[model samples]
Target: MRLIFIIVVATSLMPISAAPAQAAPLDVKGGYYHFIGDEGGDVDVTAQAAVLRNMEALTQYRSIADGSTFPGWQKEWINNLGPGVDRNFVLELNYYGAGEPTIPRPQTVDGVVVPAPDMTIQQRPGDTWKWAYGYRQVTSGQVDPLLKRALDQLKTMPYAETVNIQLGSEFDTDHEFGTTENGIAHGWAASDARALTAVQYIIGYFRSHGLPAGVTFSIGMGGWHRASFRRMHPEWLRGDVQVLQWNAYNHGTPRTPYQVFNRTRAWAIEDLPRWRTKEVVIAEWGTTANVGNQAVWIAGAGAAIKRINTDGRGFRIGTLTYYDNDPNWGELMDRDAGLEALRSVYTARPFIG
Candidate 1:
């Protein structure tokens, strides 16, 4: 009688959550993905993963950014997560900073070397730093020289499989185009338009090279911001966007906040579908500070990445990158065990087969 009772109770309890899912292999047609940032899972495979390196040529100069300290500055992971690299891991093509930042070292024109301060180099939200100062140079045609230099260097490096630009985190820091009050997702901001034009040039540049054969630009928003943009910029929703992502940085209180449970309900169910992006993802999400327990929370978030039913084709979530802050912000994984969560997710991250 006791055994029967115990067995019945165990079976009666329902599963709290499902294990995190991985993305499907993306083709020209586009389908399911698994960089499940919504659930805090990722698809970073060091060998097969796409790591963004700094364009040394650009950062070598200091005016654009302190070549020695800022820009591609790499840092130690919270738990010494995978291939220990510093904070300088952004996909920013270096060598373009014949003046201050990025790589590939462009050639001189008219005996002058200046990294056009107009071209924008985007970073995650709430931070300061950019590719250029404003659209002043972009419209002046100064970006042409820098663009030429960038194209030259990109050709020599390892081919980037997908260049995913998860938009919306551009929450107006001191960067050039981002300085305006217009929300990053506003879409009508002049600076935003210039950035779009620049990105189009970048896509055109790469497509001409045959490396990626195509280019993908991604954008994301949190529940709060998503509502604002949807009402303000209804036209922002379109079929052109290849990768649509979501931000899941559940922050505030206790330094590092526990996410998963809330995210499953928020990102998976509410936010993703409301945005109607072709590919759904939690582009950036992680707990801040807290050491010993970070691993569990991070992994839990991954496991909790629940899938939602939609009308479009079925697909997995895309990458869920752990947001690592360089320059040692108190909230970052500077010297703690928080990285274990990040490592576990990537280690067990799903593949696109």
Candidate 2:
């Protein structure tokens, strides 16, 4: 489930070729996590993409159930981008959140149906949030039709020159999608195993059916939560998956670029072994309206990334995108300060293949 309230926003992977004596220079791409126009907002998708040309952008291909259908706005959003655009499209295949895995007599808030807990995954110790789940059905082949339809839809999209299909958003965060069965909460380790299996299955399914030339697939989580999962299950970062992705936000007290991206820098340079060999993406990152130094943070964000790319660190920190197009959070509208801050980064370090 994508964080619709506090949000941010994959690809078929290239085979991991044997490492060259000296890897190519890191090219850190820039873009946003969501496009407002696609969500019935006033912004124009084409115009927005044009401004951030040659960068990576994000949108969702959502499904609420095993057989849930694509919404009207999804097709319109794809059509708006058209063909021959220089941007990379990251179509997040989001499933089951906020009124999903339906249970009896769900409560409604603000005229919206509250989603029932997924009983497939059991709750574990230290779990605080009720939304976490392992997506067992998806990986178990119970929803092949829905997954296939999403791939087919992307294949027909003229705008998807380079597509990255992220399997689901932030599942590793224990509390966000924990498992439960019949009112009983169980341990989390089993669900964790299930989550990893689901990723492996999704990757194989995509590989077998295939994506377009530049498209690939990956799984994502909160940057803070990923290290724990990776440590316990080293296999999470291995195999056919070529990208290391996570949502990066400055939710703590306001932070400097160095402070904010420092963890990412560590992951690339020291903490995560073999991370240097894969593409690392800060899938979602931004400052809040009250952060005071939004422009500075925004500008510093890009500069920090650029420094990593050029510092001869052998790190592949590609794609530093913001949360969204709304003004309330890390908005990047025409008049917003974040837009210029990001544009400067894109201008200085142009997007490359």
User: For this target, which candidate reaches the highest TM-score against the unseen true structure?
Assistant: 2
TM-score for each model: 0.51, 0.70
lDDT comparing candidate 1 with the true structure: 0.37
Over 165-250, each residue of candidate 1 has an lDDT whose tens digit, in order, gives 33334322212323332123223344445544444444444455553333355433443343433322234434435655444554
Candidate 1: regions farther than 4 A off: 1-133, 162-194, 205-211, 219-224, 227-240, 253-277, 280-283, 290-292, 308-316, 326-336, 347-353
Candidate 2, after superposition: displacement of residue 222 in Å? 1.3
> What ranges in model 2 sit over 4 Å off?
1-27, 34-44, 50-56, 59-61, 64-74, 79-134, 159-161, 174-177, 181-189, 229-233, 268-271, 325-329, 332-335, 350-353
Alpha-carbon RMSD, candidate 2:
10.0
- Give the Cα lDDT of each candidate: 0.37, 0.53
Please state the error at residue 44 of candidate 1 in Å.
14
